[model samples]
Target: MKRKAPSNPVTQTQKQLSLEDDKVKALFNQKIWDPKFQDELKDEIANAKPYNWGTIHDLVDDDLLRAVRKEIETEIHFTKKETDIYKVNQSGDLANLSGLDWNDLSRLPNMYKLRQILYSEKYRDFFGYVTGAGKLSASKTDMSVNTYTKGCHLLTHDDVIGSRRISFILYLPDPDRKWKSHYGGGLRLFPSIKENIPYTDPCAKLVPQFNQIAFFKVQPGFSFHDVEEVRVDKHRLSIQGWYHIPQKGEDGYIPGEEEAWIDQNISTLAQLESRTLQDFEFPNAEREILPFHQTKHYERLLTGEEDNNKDCKFLSEALKLTEREIQYLSQYISPEHLTAEGITKLQKSFEDNSSLQIESFLNDPKSDLLKKLIKHDELNKECPMEAKDVKAPWKTATPSHKWRYLYMDGKSHEYFATEEDMLENLNNEEPSNFKWLKETLINAKTSNNDNELEIALVDLAQFLKSLIFKKYIATLTLLCPLAEKVIIRRFRPGKDFTLATKCNLSEVLKGVEGFVDAVLEATLCLTPSNGWTSGEVGGYELYMADETIDEEEKDDTQYERDVEDATVYRRDDAGDSVLINKPASWNSLNLVLRDESVMEFVKYISWGAESSRWDVRIQWDVKSMESDV
Candidate 1:
């Protein structure tokens, strides 16, 4: 009988691992399947605020979960990955375990068993019932193990992507001790102001413990959430996974259902392209065209109409700072940067690299005064921790999906809470004003008060918006400014960031003569702390090339995988895509001529950071030198 084919151990193990209803039930806490318990959970989920979500304590059997954690610790290797949105030590997708041979699976036998049980029909049915996310596909086993060490975090984003029916996280932090709220790494849920617009802050937070599982249905335009930065030096381990809509042969599978769901919830990139969503974004990329009178000075200077000189002479004369201009600028700008030679060198560097960083950009008196004021404010005064608490002249950048920070836009607009507030402001004309700057300067000459820091920053913003300063920028970048927007921003530790975004040129400037399809951007870093050089504290400014996927090479599953593994699509690993990475520094001015193809962001500030990242961010709609001349 052909030697009775020595009983195949591998096949036997596979058969043993096939999760049956009884076996699956035994792997989880017994109460999970209780009819009364399920009913309670369903009701709790339905009543949950900030969109329906549920959590179960003692989700898995203690011994089994411990065994699974042990196997993961020994058998799995994690890579520390950082992108624009998150930083975490992550393992390869656990879904790939199905493809592993029996020998490979043997090394992580408990993990394999856990995956099988989690996606098993019995458990999925229970999960679907509790969350009211009907019919999850067992075939699509999506999971990854992530360990958020010190400073690791994920910024706000809705878990809306292809076929993702429900999102869940199984915490496996030290099973022996309680996971306290102070430890950070809390799952923060944000309430929506309107569809697709999350509040500036999270209203609900879940501090996970070992053997606890938190889950929610993946609702588009809602369900915005983030993983708070792990503040302490602890490994907060969790298994994050998603349940997909029923597949082709599954019980609840309906023809075209998944496709229609995907269509309804567009990809992030597609949402960004939608005009409707752009209206809700704060500090909108919109640039206000400088009044013709203000711009005519630079235009005449560049074209040599002021002096009627030849090309070389006109260029030399335009680049040289006049005595009065130098005298006025010397109060705020470093003498070295104001010199003719220094200006020529800066222009040359910018021409070559399309970027420049000038250290000690501010003069000694101004730098020393501003630094003292800012550092004092940080240490002594309580920084406003909420949107409502943010006072006049300083507004919180809103909508959260695009960016969040405290900013002063050199305007006197009130704090806007709703779309209607923004609309009302749009309908009413409130041109830029320097009344605060005037008052601040007067106050500085008279007294040393609590508002000195705000006054000084506002004063600097006005100077940056001045025509003389624009002339200085013109000489440095060799680009004539057509329009300008100046903002003084504060990225508070653990609370503020800007997501990766491309320059949005104003519609009026798009095809105008002499116009360049770029924004001349500058950042004057005012962060007073010292330990941010390595970017470990997460307050670095980074610029990269926007990546485009070829249509022919695009995968239908790309959006799903991008959401799962953000690092894979970052393009920074190659080193070529990243154009600039500037850590927060005191008194350094960074200038970058950014086209539509370049993406930029200030990384999320970590809670462990020494202080807030402070900067003056300026952008000018610029025109080419050749076109101007």
Candidate 2:
């Protein structure tokens, strides 16, 4: 009998592995694989409002998953990686199992078994049927484990990467304890504003539990989601992985679909760069308002190339300002900033650098009243934390994957209105200055009004937009007769931040060489807390250089991986940053002329902060005369 075929060693090994796999399948809720259960699941997934997704409980054998968790805790090393979009401790790619050495593999037997069973043909077919994603690759496996502690979060994004057909997460957060929704760490899915722009708010959320698995088809331009920040000082551990399209030699392999899928999924970076989309989505894009003749004079003032008295005369003439207008402005403006000598010195310094910080931007009387009111509100008022709770005269910034804060748009009386609505709302019959100054005086006298906060903010905005102040701006930065926007922003402790992003030049301003590509941004900080020292409690502003990538490196995925993620950078990284970092302080002002190549962000405020970071922000579109020269 051919020596009994040596008892068929291969058959024995296969039989042993098959028994282990069966044990793993028994761990899952049996109904998951049942025909009737799957039919209901498929219907639920297809009709799930907001997006198509599904979740299953008791997805793994408790004893096996417990062993896998123990293996990870003891055998793996985790690195803390933080970016603008997320902060988590992550293990090396668990997908590279075949590359591990014998010693490493020996320490991860349970994990190895878990991975094998997850990708086993039987389970793959079930997942495919439910998701309608077709066959998954046998040769390709991509996954990693992450632990999010307090304050850790992943911002919104559709996990559409090279050849990825489906995405899943298996949660293992403290198997003995229940994970509460208020503890955060829930998977939040977003709705779309359009084809590619996800809305700022999440429409659906899934709170995870031990032995739970959540998954969705990796649909490009749609499936946007984020992991809510883990609060309450606990660890949220989960294994995240992707199933790619069938690779070469696998069943249902397609020759070019992987590459095609990757090419079709546009990145957030590319979408942000799209002019038409940005114009529609951006709440404020710097508008061009200064006439050619006025812009030329403004440029000359900044360069110090024109006679000082002549430039002053030009400003006086161009703004068409009367002495009466200057007198009215002096009522709220600091006397020190109104003089010729003060203006000239500011001009020289600003031309030399492109930034300035004015300590007492508001006159003493006005500053005192504003600070007192702001402090009272901070201590006594119930600040709105959610976007939905924000009241009129205040709107929460949208698509918060990029930024989050409450701001008053000056014209918030028309809160539900559009930019076009602004033009119609304006009293074209009356002079802009006349309306502005009148509002300022009324707010100044009504310091004790019930609406003191709103009035103070609007008053301060009017001061920044006043003719005398505009003249000072023109004299110093040569960016006058400019289009201006004033926003009163409040960043609550532990709740607000703005991610690192570059200034996008408005469509009409793009490609116009010699025109200043910089936006003149100003902030008047009014934090009520102390010890914001060294960014420990965060609430600091940082400006850094845009990372430069070589042309050849763009296509090299390895090189891209080596670079810090585009959405974030290390604080100590070497790059040409026009240093203007400032901590949140009471009654201080910071001004910087930021160019398109510079990236900026307000660091997330820590929960330990004594109070919120409050400020009035002003941005302007400054025209350049370099082309004329």
Largest TM-score belongs to which candidate?
A: 1
In model 2, the runs with Cα more than 4 Å from the true position are 1-29, 92-99, 291-353, 357-364, 412-449, 474-481, 493-495, 506-514, 534-538, 548-551, 554-581, 606-608, 623-629
Question: What TM-score does candidate 1 get on C-alpha atoms?
Answer: 0.92
Which segments of candidate 1 are over 4 A away from where they belong? 1-16, 93-98, 299-319, 415-429, 436-449, 562-574, 627-629
As a TM-score, model 2 comes out at 0.80
TM-scores for all candidates? 0.92, 0.80
- Alpha carbon lDDT at 102, candidate 1: 72
lDDT of 1 by residue, 79-110 (tens): 88787778888876442343456776868778
User: Clashing residue pairs, candidate 2?
Assistant: none
Error of 2 at 125 (Å): 2.1
Scored against the true structure, residue 233 in model 2 reaches a CA lDDT of 85
